[model samples]
Target: MQQTTVAKTVTYTGIGLHSGKSVTITLHPAPINSGIIFARTDLPGIPQVAAVAGNVTNAMRATTLESGVAKVFTVEHLLAAFYAMGIDNCLIEINSVEPPVADGSSLPFVRLLEEAGSVEQEALRNIIDVKEAQTIRVNDSFITIVPYDGFRITFTSINPHPMLGVQFGDYEINTETFVKEIASARTIGFMHEVKLLQDQGLALGGSLENVVVYDDETVLTPLRFSDELVRHKILDVVGDLALVGRIKGHVIAVKSSHAINTALAKKIIESCSK
Candidate 1:
C-alpha cells in the first residue's frame, strides 16, 4: 500500500480533557515519508514533535509526547482516528498542549478527517510484520503480537464495576471497521477513579459530556455498547500501535494499558529493525 496524506487542511475545536482549555487543532497534508508529526501552533514558530514511542513521557492519565521544549498530551484518540482513516503522513497543528477531548471518543476526529479528504502518496508504505511471537505483561495485564497477514486485534478488559465487567471484542481492522466499530468508544473511567484523577490534577475538563463515567452498577450516560470498555481498549491499541509508524500484523491484547502498549510497539520496532 502507498503512504497517504490529507488533500486539504481540516480544523477541529473543543475542550481539552486536561487543562480544561479551549483548543483548536488543524491537520495539514505532509509530504510522502514525512510520517505523523505534531506541531505546536500556539508556540512561537510552531515547534514540531514526531509521534514516536520514544517520545512518550507520561502515561498516567493519558499518553503524552514531549520534545526539547514542546509537549502534547492525550493524543492517542486523535492518533487512533488518523490511523483508522489510513492517513500515514500529516502535520497536526495544535493551538494547545492538549487536544480537544471531543466527546471523549475518536468519532469527532474521524469525522473531521473524513471532511479533510485523503490522497495517496508516491512512496510505498512500511509495515512491521512480526515473524515471531512476542509478549509483554505487567501483573494480570498482558498484550501480544504474533505473525499475521494484515491488521487484526482482539482485546479484553476486566473491571469489577458491574457496568464494565469482563468484556471482549475481536475485529479485523480496516479503515471502515475502525471508524464504525471503535472510533466512538469513549475513554471510560470509574467513578471511584475520578476522585483520584482529579486529586492528581488530571481530567480537568472531563465530564459527563466528554467521558463515560461508570459508577458501581451503571454508566453515567447511555451505554454505547455492552462491550464498549473492551472496544475502547481496542481503540487505544490502534492509537498506541500507530507509534510504530505503520500498520501491520495482528495483536492480541488482554487487559493492556498505555504502558504495555508502548512497550510492545517499541519491542516490535526493535525486533523488525534487526
Candidate 2:
C-alpha cells in the first residue's frame, strides 16, 4: 500500500486536558517517510519533536513526547485519529504543551482529518509486520501482539466500579469501523478520584462535556457506546502504537495503561531493529 498524507491544512482550537490552557493545533501535509512530527510554535526556534516511542518521556495519564525543552502532552487522541485514518505523514504545529481535549475522544480529530481529505503518495508504506508473538506484562496488566494480516485489537478493561466492572471489545481497525465505533468513546474518570487527580495536577480541564465521569453507582454522563470505556482503551492503544509505524498485527490488551501500551511499542521497535 502507498503512503498517504493530509491533502490540505486544517486547524482546531480547544482547552488542554491537563494544562487547562487554550491551544490551537494545525495539521499540515508532510512528505513520504516523514511519519508524524510535532512543532512547538510557542518555544524559541520552534523546536520539533518526532512522534516516536524513543521520544516518550512520560506516560502517566497521557502520552508525552519530549526533546530537550520541547514537550507535547496528551497526544494519544490526535495520534489515534491519524493512525486509524491511514495517514502516514503529518506535521502538527501547536502553541502549547498539550493538544486540545475535544470531547476527550478521537472523533473531533477524525473530523478534522476528514475535512482535510487525504492524498496518496508514490512511496510504499513503512509497515511493521509482526512475525511472532510478543508480550509485555506489568503485574496483572499486559499487552500482547501477534502476527496478523491486518491491524486488529482485542481489549479488555476491568474496573471495580459497579457500573463499569468488565468490558471487552475487538475491532478490525479501518476508517469506517474507527469512525463508527471507536472515535467517539470519551475518556473516563471516577468521582472519587477527581479531587485526587486535581491535587496531583491532572484532569484540570476535564468536564462532563469532555469526559465520562462515573460516580459510585452510575455514569454521570451519557455513553456513546455501552462499552465506551473499553473502546476508548482501544483508541488509546492505537494512538500509543502510532509511535511505531503502520502495524500489521493483532494486539491483545487487558487492563493496560499508557505506560504498558508504549512499552509494547518500544518492544516492537526493538524487535524490528534487530
Best candidate, lDDT: 2
Deviation from native of the Cα of residue 263 in model 1, angstroms: 0.9
Model 2, CA-based lDDT:
0.95
lDDT of each: 0.88, 0.95
Q: Return the TM-score for each candidate structure.
A: 0.97, 0.98
The parts of candidate 1 lying over 4 Å away from their true place are none
Which pairs of residues clash in candidate 1, taking residues 3 or more apart in a chain or in different chains? none
Cα error of candidate 2 at position 217, Å: 1.2
- Per-residue C-alpha lDDT of model 2 across residues 1-274, encoded as one tens digit per residue: 9999999999999999988899999999999999999999999999999999999999999999999988998999999999999899999999999999999999999999999999999899988999999899999999999999999999999999888889999999988999999999999998898999999989999999999999989899998889999999999999999999889999999999999999999999999999
Query: What is the C-alpha RMSD, rounded to one decimal, of candidate 1?
Result: 1.1
Clashes of each: 0, 0
